[model samples]
Target: MNLQQLYYFKTIAQLEHYTKAAEQLNVSQSRLSHAIGDLEKELQVTLFVHQGRNVKLTRCGAFLLEYVSQSLDILDRGLEKLSDFVNPDTGSIGLSYLGSLANFVTFCISRFFEKTGKVQVHFQFNQTVTQTIEDSLMEGHTDLAFTTPFDNKNIESVKIGSHKTILIVSRDHPLAAQDSVDLTTLANETFVTYSPQCMIRNHIDEIFQTVGIQPKISFEALYDSIVLGVVSANLGVALVAEAVDLTGCHVKALQIENEIPEREIHMAWVKDRYMTPAVKCFRDFIMESGMLLDQYKKK
Candidate 1:
């Protein structure tokens, strides 16, 4: 019913042991049990089932926990916004992006800071999958996200530019000397690739599917740099965007002869969401700096 009761319930639900929960909360076990019991009475529902040492949430308890978690998450976001407003000179901006765009995004961020040093930025590198990048924005976890386009009406996005996903192999690789190579040529070669959850990996998969060739994906990685490093180690070849940092790795980036569309990068945010001054300013700078310009100018 109250925040204290909900807090007690959440803690007990997580630990599933009243005694342990009490110790962790630095309160007496009786007090912990009394609070939870009062909460159950107020809600008119049995929230837990206990077996001597362990406690488990009943179906109603589980449902309540879901909503309780969501409420706490929203409260956290509100507090963050309030803090940012109170300190406008150093507004905080939460940014989310794919690993492949690290170099380009970093360049943009550095440029932004050069112009406005007072802004504080927090970054969430979502190497998991494309969905998470979008989710970060929609769930209020991040203010803005750089990712591929998705058909989510809840978001408003603007296309930045497109970049080519070039083929990368070790300098001593068998096909490295060639000017360009067909996708089919690498069919038998062991492949190092991004996780299937990655947007670029999905695009790469589609290219292979179109050519009717299934590559032997021996290893999976999240970042373009890591994939390239794995390839340079002669572990396997990979397909990564040209924005990947290749300074230290001895790798050859070959053009793919097969017709593959360039990867489209977009900056997306939740529609109608309040944009902090920091987020708004940097977003404008990013759009103007040409970092989002069509680097791969496809004919």
Candidate 2:
């Protein structure tokens, strides 16, 4: 039977009186009876039997009632979830970003939550490399990314801010004593850098290439923190974004005498994917806050 008939059946089964059920449902008793009669005729089973002025479900009716109750409950929950999904005040967002942007993302999220008091937006964070972030967006596994600009045509990006490249060397390293050093002088020094798959690695490679020298790479790590850790042990020197936290690492940051392009950070998403209200809320917040650049300036 149709959903309406099933609903009527459930209501009648619960109340156990046709007149009362019809009144609660805002329908005529005869209309309710005819609907149930049609349903029983379709199912070829007597659903109810008179108990004086009241009605009691038949054996078959009781079994059907159990299934109908479960099905209706499931449908009601589904409807509720759908409403929440579209509502800006509540929903979930799949957010991905580079490990280097962890602090910035945290600040943005905290501020966003503060601004939207009583909001219930949940974030699923994926800290990954630029390539994987792009793939996730394309595959619909991720809704937004704080990363380097994607080269894919299917991905759209907005430049959020830039990070000045800096050099990190061990505390005891000779260059650590210098206020600034030229890249040409470090041509023969061992370098600790991100893996080739990482977007920051590509930027580092470009800088080295621009200086007309190939750095002697001694170590490759996935994240900036790992690279800094390697440099702290005097394993090798590293070029990394200035935003990278130098808190616990015993590495000295140095300014580059040589001109280098700042590492650009972007907020990227799939070009043609449906954005949930939560996703839009976050994306818009970041875009409007100017917090990215403000944080960089504070640094």
Candidate 3:
């Protein structure tokens, strides 16, 4: 029920063994067991199941573990924020972005540091950048996020600009020589695609559904890099953000007509977050660097 109990439960779930968790917590195994038992009794849900020495989180335990993890992250960020207040300019700016926006992200970071010379920036990449942005903003896990737009009502987002969607294929593919190809043309072809949960994947699916076309899917990758690699290996073709360069493996772009609309990438933060100085500087830099504008104008 309390932070300590939640923390104890989380530690046990993570270690997967009461004895090891006790050793790590610097407490007796009996005490750790009692705490977990008390937590389960109060919450009226079994948190873990044990077979001899090995312990695994039960369904309820897995659910609670998520809550505990988020709570810990909030606490850690809160502490970091407090520490940052002691020295504003040198404070860390936690950033997360989609892999497809690597170039834009790199350019933005470079420009921000070069221009500001006062703010320290820390960046991380997430395959699901939109969800990462939403979660980070909602849970205070990050200071800012560069992500694609999503219909999450819990955050404030500024649409910087959009990035083009291009069809990529291996050199040996028959359609690789085409100037552009219709989505309908690939209806029966095995397609290599990113995970269905990705924003671009959803957009691609919508386009296919609208046109009454279904490409036979060969693979689904979690990362844009992997999808491009798969396509270049002649596994299948995919529509992806143009940030990927298919130079290595007999690759070519098959432009889709009526061009699938560019995905809108944005800078997002929690709606009511008290903006830290470092975070504000990073945000200002992104808006000023024209990275978004440049991406919008790409051929």
Evaluated at residue 244, the lDDT of candidate 2 is: 84
Candidate 2's error at 28, in angstroms? 3.9
User: Is candidate 2 or 3 superior in TM-score?
Assistant: 2
- Local distance difference test scores for all models: 0.79, 0.88, 0.75
For model 1, residues 1-299, the per-residue Cα lDDT tens digits are 78877778888888899988988889999988888888889899999998789999999999999999888879879988788654645676777877667766666676677777754665445544587877777889888888888889999888888878788889988887887889876778898988877778788888888777989999997667678778989999888887676788899888888887777789888888888776787777776756354643331
For 1-299, candidate 3 gives per-residue lDDT tens digits of: 77888878888888899999989989998988888889889989998999788899999889878978998989989988777653546666667777766666677766566777764544545445455557766787777777776687877778888767778888888887798987777777778887766667787787678667877987997777788788878988888876765556568887778545567778877777777766777777676655564553562
- Which residue pairs show backbone clashes in model 3? 171-250
Worst 10 residues of 3 by lDDT: 119-128
| lDDT, candidate 3, at 221 | 77
Per-model TM against the reference = 0.64, 0.90, 0.65
Candidate number that wins on lDDT, 1 or 2: 2
Candidate 2 — which residues are off by over 4 angstroms? Answer: 294-296
Summing lDDT over every window of 10 consecutive residues in candidate 1, give the lowest-scoring window: 290-299
Give me the candidate number with maximum lDDT: 2
- Comparing 1 and 2 by TM-score, which wins? 2
Pairs clashing in candidate 2?
A: none
Error of 2 at 212 (Å): 1.2
